[model samples]
Target: MSLEDLYREVILDHYRSPRNKGHLDSPDFRAEGVNPLCGDEITIDLAFDGDQVSQVAISGQGCSISQSSASMMSEAIKGKTKGEIEDLTKRFRDMMSLDGEADIGLDPDRPGAVLGDLESLQGVRKYPVRIKCASLGWNVLLEALDGEPLT
Candidate 1:
């Protein structure tokens, strides 16, 4: 099968059986975001081990792109320091072309090779309308990173 087809399959797999799809009873940080344009919403709950993310739980409702993005983000950020997660977030945003560029520092030909399964979402950029759907989870993650801890 083609690379594009492979990526599409990866996305579908994540959507159908998402990882970290739940809630944390006590999260160090938590944030929720909504894409009013498309009604995609995501809530990120983080449990940190000092400066690193020890655990992550995500509960939300949205399209495949948004939900799968959350699943991928949860996998990528676990056991990562806030700084590392921030860098990964920037790299992911770059891949999404949200910052006017898409330089993920790896060969786009071999997507799953790096960034876990996130690069699979790159194709969403082709449809500008779906970009937000693809990034709704990342946006919520950023808010959780920068916002105050959950009370």
Candidate 2:
């Protein structure tokens, strides 16, 4: 009915049916991130074909916010080129900051037509503590892209 309700539904959907939630098999890169404050942890594995991310996977356990955010992260970057994925990652990070109304790395005209429900986490700006929870997997994924081991 309302936008908040829609966001809640989106979050719930991701939490209930997590995407890419498993171990990596011969992954090209992997990285892990932990939020000591909340004990939220995530490890992401990335497989790149040249500059494109051919596949992404993860294994982790945490609160619904962390796990669902990880699910959304995996889904958003699938089939995306390295540059495009990086742009989306920046956009997602900017959204979490709620710095302004600009879509940052997104096409302002189209918004998140492609990212779909995953964009609902923009509301996370309201919960400062949960910001790290939502970013856990994304940060780890970035490390994987950088060819760093999961720390």
Candidate 3:
């Protein structure tokens, strides 16, 4: 199997059986994000342990890219401190960004150098319009972290 095939399989696996695909009963933080252009929506609930994320749950409905990306985001953010999440978010956004400015040494040839399985979704960059679909969950994550209201 080729690398692309592996990425596809990873994405499919996450979409079919999303991680943390639910909601916390009393989360410390909660927020939602919507990509109106593609009708993708996501809600994230987070519980913090001191300065770190102790738990996360996500609820949403959308395309495979959106849901799977949410699953990956939940997994990545767990046990991450506020600063770590911020840096990871930047790297993830830079990875999905069209502009060539990944200051964190994220080379396209080595997309997984920072994000682990989340890198599998880098293919979404090929479809410019679908970028929002994949980023819906991440945006929601930011909102929750910032204590922003659901939208």
Note the Cα lDDT for every prediction shown: 0.85, 0.76, 0.83
Per-candidate RMSD vs. true structure?
Answer: 2.3, 3.6, 3.5
Q: Which digits, one per residue and each the tens of the lDDT, describe model 1 over residues 27-95?
A: 989999988887887888999888889989999898888999899889999899988998988888898
Tens digits of per-residue lDDT, candidate 2, 48-149, equal 777777788878889877888899889888888878878877777777774444354544477457466666776677777777887788788777787753
TM-score of each: 0.91, 0.82, 0.86
Query: Quick one: best TM-score, which candidate?
Result: 1
- How much does candidate 1 score in TM-score? 0.91
lDDT of 3 at 50: 84
Distance from true position, residue 25, model 1, in Å?
A: 0.7
Query: Candidate 2: TM-score?
Result: 0.82
Error of 2 at 107 (Å): 10
lDDT of 3: 0.83
Model 2 ranges with Cα > 4 A deviation: 1-7, 98-114, 148-151
Worst 10 residues of 2 by lDDT: 98-107
In candidate 3, which residue ranges exceed 4 Å CA deviation? 1-7, 98-113, 148-151
